[model samples]
Target: MTDMRVSIAGVKFKNPILVASGTFGFGHEYGKFYDLSELGGICVKGTTLHKRDGNPAPRIAETPSGILNSVGLQNPGVDAFCAEEMPFLKRFDTKIVANISGNTLEEYSELAEKVAAAGVDMIEVNISCPNVKAGGLAFGTSCTSAAAATEAVKNHAGSVPVMVKLSPNVTDITEIARAVEAAGADALSLINTLLGMRIDLKTRRPILKNNTGGLSGPAVLPVAVRMVWQVANAVKLPLLGMGGVASGADAAELMFAGASAVAVGTALFNDPYAPIRVRDELAEYCENAGVARVSELTGGVKPW
Candidate 1:
């Protein structure tokens, strides 16, 4: 039998398929569709130090092959998640990854401490959020800010692994990857979301209330694969690749490109069972490819 298990920074996942944060919520809603334990891991919604009302309405819009969203990290805050959501997620056998975002170094450090102490299997730091102290620039956009954020979280994360999520909006993702790695990040997740926008032709105005949003879907797959490959070459840390993964082939492609694991995002909006389907399909692919283990697919691509 092909070995589907993969470990990211010592945290073992039953498989390489994970549901991206903001798409999977806390896994409670998706639990009714299938057995949550059947998959690998779940990156819970982006939580913050305090509850956020999120951006204005009409925060989502359909594009050609994907959707643009400016949800603004709507969440119940870290305290509520630890007190309420964590218990529900612990019931499942799958790994629980707390995806946290903050506006400052202090907030990230505090969030990391609380969630790690609360017993999360991993902490996925969303540095795509703007850094208030850095003139509103995203921490992931600059090596210095990114490294600082990673260092702050690592200082308080205790033993739980800290995985820094990199933004695609930057010019050089590999540079940011190397910075976070040097700052003590145990693993890395890439291609958070590309900056995009939509407009109504007749109205001569933007479609989303926020004017612009992050684009996610099959549209960003190529970019995601490229960034993953580049970062994999640049850093020694394991990578959790995500962007537009919708099928087992897509997952395999990302793995081949360099992802130690993959996450399903916008696909979940259309099919709640996408993660399970991807896992099963990936297993089938490995079996057909005569592969003994799925981990072998990581960084398996050959350059011509």
Candidate 2:
């Protein structure tokens, strides 16, 4: 089984490194830089039932080691995705997971149904997107709402694997994790960008149009690892950890912390092919560590 791969929610991924949603931009942008098919899969930009204009300009701000953005899930509607992005993306070899957002439970259920019916390889119920309203975090921060949102979508996700993306803005990630698990999430993606902001000292003003935005980049790596580890322990579902993951070292660290897979976020912004390089590094690391498969690294942490 040296060449065997991992399957999450009945969907097979060629590897364990995926490009996180919002960062990859439908996988086509990165395809210009490298062969994304070399990686495991791609979580596309978040889509709603209708197209979104997103927030105003000055949307992104640079922090010390991280960046804050309130792009506001700016994507063509779910129907447009099926007609446009999907046809082009399906031409690629990698699996496609449609990331979806909605303001209410009914909206979420309807969005999931539309995307699932569109034949995406999988669906990530985007309960934690920081850019939108309906208290996006409100649906993800608590066990009650998290479970309810997950359950609502789960009922209609059909055969497509439904992974609930969790917010890092919560008090206890594990509590939310367990709640979604009980709601029938096939897998979990953790640490959707942490809430943060930046100030332009020179301008004496907040940098972003939205006073605060989600922080993502190398600075968020450690927090992502901790949250992934905590949530992985709390739920039996597979976990995809991301946020501030930029290098092979970061990938290995998260895998060691119990991530079944990892998503490359801001790193994609810097190097469009960062995901491929990280995957290559992981393969070499697995070979060097005398490990037959990268999956062996999951939970291989040493007790402190």
TM-score of each candidate? 0.97, 0.97
Q: Mark the regions of model 2 whose C-alpha exceeds 4 Å error after superposition.
A: 1-4
RMSD in Å for all candidates: 1.6, 1.4
lDDT of 1: 0.90
| Top TM-score hit | 1
Write one digit per residue (lDDT tens) for candidate 2, span 188-258. Answer: 98889888878888988888888889999999899989888887777889888788888878988998888
Q: Model 1, 215-298: lDDT tens per residue?
A: 999999999999999999999999999999999999999999999999999999999899999999999999999999999999
Candidate 2, lDDT over the whole model: 0.85
User: What lDDT score is found at residue 52 in candidate 1?
Assistant: 80
Model 1 CA deviation exceeding 4 Å by range: 130-137
Which candidate leads in lDDT? 1
